[model samples]
Target: METWKEPQTIILWIIIVALFVIILLTSIIFLVRTIFKKIIKAKEKEAAIQLDYQKNLLETTIKTQEIERHRIAADIHDGLIGKLTALKMQQEITSKDQKTIDALHESITVARRISHDLSPPLVEFTKLPELIKELLDPWEQHLLITTIFDIRAEINDTEEFKVQITRLIQEIITNTIKHAEATQMYLHLKQTENYMALYISDNGKGYDVAKNSKGLGTKNIETRVQFLKGVYKVKSKIGKGTSNMFLFKN
Candidate 1:
């Protein structure tokens, strides 16, 4: 009887040890999984915070840029415009050449237009389609290139949206005319179910866009798109020309 009791006691101790080991392993596994989940959540939170920071920074920068533009326009109108006017006034005395005087007059007119462009337009009071047409007028007589426009989207009343879209078009066309030397260009703006789409294409000398990825014009366009919470894609080839598409959510 004494030997039987000893063996039973040994069996009970073995069972107890096995149960303890199983509980310990389960706890360890649960602790490892919890820690992994916390790590993943932390990383996701950090990314969200960073994205918010970028959005806020972009908004402030755009507002500051508008203010600077206004100041520059005022300076040009007050100083450069005045000087150009004075030059035209002295045209007769400086030279009797009507051609020179006419040239000076044209310069003054161009300067005034530049100053006006530097200031924000009354987008709320104007037709966006008309404004865009006016913007394209300068390129109409570019004997080198034919410009086409297809506008099917009504203007968004939001001030920021209007200004950014208009400026985007202006800047892109300016880049194309000044750099691309393309023979043809098309500007298309359309509205879809969820957003407005802008498509610009030019047939000209495309560049190594990857090499000059951080170019001023490219950065400016990218920043503007980001400000509007939009996306843009640019495609270009050395001789095949370039096409850029932008989508702005409604």
Candidate 2:
């Protein structure tokens, strides 16, 4: 049978071509899979970046809200407190009861002074350090609190921000005396070329900052910072103390 016609050399060539085609297709599939994987990784990275940006934005918003609350607090302390104290004094004077005259006068003076201490428009007229000292003086005897202020450089001379800063300081000081159960506190004001920083630290029985669910004061502070486009942070250690920082851009 003529050695089976040598199995046809052309057929052998066709078989080789078919094998080559199969190999080529397999390589192309692998290449496509790799490209798809790379695309998926890129998308995942992009999503992560977006998530981080959103988180930062949310934090900033919360801080702004805190600032607003403090501003309102300051306003009430400044405007309403003084007006009410003045009225109280007037009422006492008109009572015509000489027996209580001395007591009434003393009480009215105390109230008026408290009002002034709580709400100082010193931002309109004086430097921040001086205003801070005047604000804390009244409470020193009551709390036995030690306050230390460290100023690295002259702070921003901007007038509009002074009132806001003073308000912030007052709030923190009140919180420390009323809640922190602390006997000592330290305040540091630092001035940089681009930022103004305030550090309020208290040595007291500290509490958890994260576990606060209904803390209006905390929320208020956070909001105000955000409103001013500042950085706000509260660091507290149980049984140790608490440190709060506010950094505003100049």
Best by TM-score: 1
Quote each prediction's TM-score: 0.81, 0.58
Relative to the unseen true structure, what is the C-alpha lDDT of residue 46 in candidate 1, on a scale of 0 to 100? 99
Instruction: Kindly list the per-residue Cα lDDT of model 2 for residues 162-244, writing each as its tens digit.
Output: 65576677778778888889988888877766778888888889988878635877766765676567898889988999999
Task: Give the Cα error of residue 182 in candidate 2, in Å.
Answer: 1.4
Candidate 1 residue-wise lDDT, 75-162, digit = tens? 9889988987788778878777799889888888787777666764566676656566766776677624344445455545576677
Which candidate number would show the highest lDDT if scored against the true structure? 1
The Cα RMSD of model 1 versus the native structure comes to 3.3
After superposition, which runs of candidate 2 have C-alpha atoms over 4 Å from their true positions?
A: 1-99
lDDT of each: 0.79, 0.72
What TM-score should be assigned to candidate 1? 0.81
TM-score of 2: 0.58
